[model samples]
Target: MKKLIPISIAILFIAVIILFVMQCNVSKECAAPAGKAETPAIRADGTDLTIAYINTDTLLLNYQLSRDLNEELLKKQEDARTNLNQEARAFESEMQEFQRKLENNGFLSRDRAEREQQRLINREQELKDLNAKLSNELMVRQQEISSQLLDSITIYLKEMNLDKDYDLILSTTVGGTILHAKDGLNITGEVLDALNNRYKKKK
Candidate 1:
């Protein structure tokens, strides 16, 4: 089976991460200078604008829900492939039998031979349709799983932020624009740990 997960799904998580981070910053007016102080950036309403970033690629890899979903999807794809292969083998056998009948004039009449040919064509079409349908269904399910994982991350961020009082929690990819930050600003490990812990409780 081809890669069950799409890179677009990772991009989708990036988009969702950005949106949630924006929500955290939306109420704040502006940012403070880098390395200004340990204190968070202050909002016009006297709120702190503590900002941190997570490595999204790392998060996706370590995130328990994502791992679980990936395994499940892989299994589903393998099963689908096995079933399709079986169907293909059966179709090939029938096709060979049809060819043999044609060559030996086993059909009682020309009309019967043509009818068998049409039937084989129709069966082949059905198998093709089935394969396409199964593939499409799996794709849809993968998308749903991706969205669900994003929702899980978003919810966990909200809960964690409530206690941590962060104003913005950004997610960065390996080669994203966020080039440098102090070790203190990287919250990926903490977030991944929390996410896994929460997932464990749920399971």
Candidate 2:
């Protein structure tokens, strides 16, 4: 089975959030610093613009929901592959039988031989169509799982931010746009813990 691409939810969510923040700042007539600063950037409101980051790679790997969904997907892929393989083997066996019948002159007439040949061809096409359909279904299922995971994380983050403790929350992953950030700013562990606890309660 072909491996599904890892979800890059961090990159996507971060890009959108950054754009929204920029728009908000522009509306408030807040001027961003011309250069990078060692400390957290101050917002237009004069309070410390608290920024925290979540390492999405870590979060996904540790989050139970993600792991369960991933495992389920893998199992589904395996089952699809197994079924396809079995059908393919059956088709191959039929082809071999047809070849044997042709060699042995077992067909009563040319028309019958042609009909069997056409039948085999049709079966082959059916197998190809089945393979394509299964692949597409698996891809769709993977996308749906990814969307669910993203929605869960987004909802949790929205709730977590109700207190307005962090002015900006960013997401980072390995080899992501955020190359470096302070240890204090990395809230991956805290967020992961809370998310897992919430998920546990739900189950």
Candidate 3:
């Protein structure tokens, strides 16, 4: 579960980048701005297309909603682990008692002893199943949280661009497809601040 968090976050970043790219493609705004010899298309008014990027790693670290969601996930993982451990310990204690009884011939008959052993086996299987179920539930929950975060960011970006200020908004991460970008075009701080403000209001 601990390992899953970083993997999930990486996937989230990739998903966000894909979402933005799809939007740019749909709007036919993915082409390079004019003045470049290889430019594919230019605005009718001949103005340079505005572009901005958000550092997804930075956003995930500073965004209040993201931090809150991550903490929620950690809490859930911890709870599930603690519960499983308690059940396992209880089961072990019962098994030890059963072993002691069998060794001392405490059961009235062989059939009774066999029944107790079978019941323990069944209980072990039940515990295994429960562990698997909890893991699956946590995975599903992580995915839901990721989707929610992506949607929130997408909607905010769309709203921020309502004025058509940026023709393209890109998502960047450490060692991502975007290797280098001008600091001037980085809007991560602005975006993170707004997102945190909006999340606070919602809370």
* Candidate 3 structure quality by residue, lDDT tens digits, 111-132: 9999999999999998888888
Model 1 agreement with the true structure over 125-168: per-residue lDDT tens digits? 88888788778877877778877887888888888887887767
Q: Write down the TM-score of every candidate.
A: 0.81, 0.81, 0.82
lDDT scores in order: 0.75, 0.72, 0.75
Q: What is the lDDT of residue 80 in candidate 1?
A: 78
**Candidate 2: which stretches are off by over 4 Å?**
1-42, 45-48
Residue 43 alpha-carbon offset, candidate 1, angstroms: 5.4
Could you give the candidate ranking by TM-score, starting with the highest? 3, 2, 1
lDDT against true structure, model 2: 0.72
lDDT of 3: 0.75
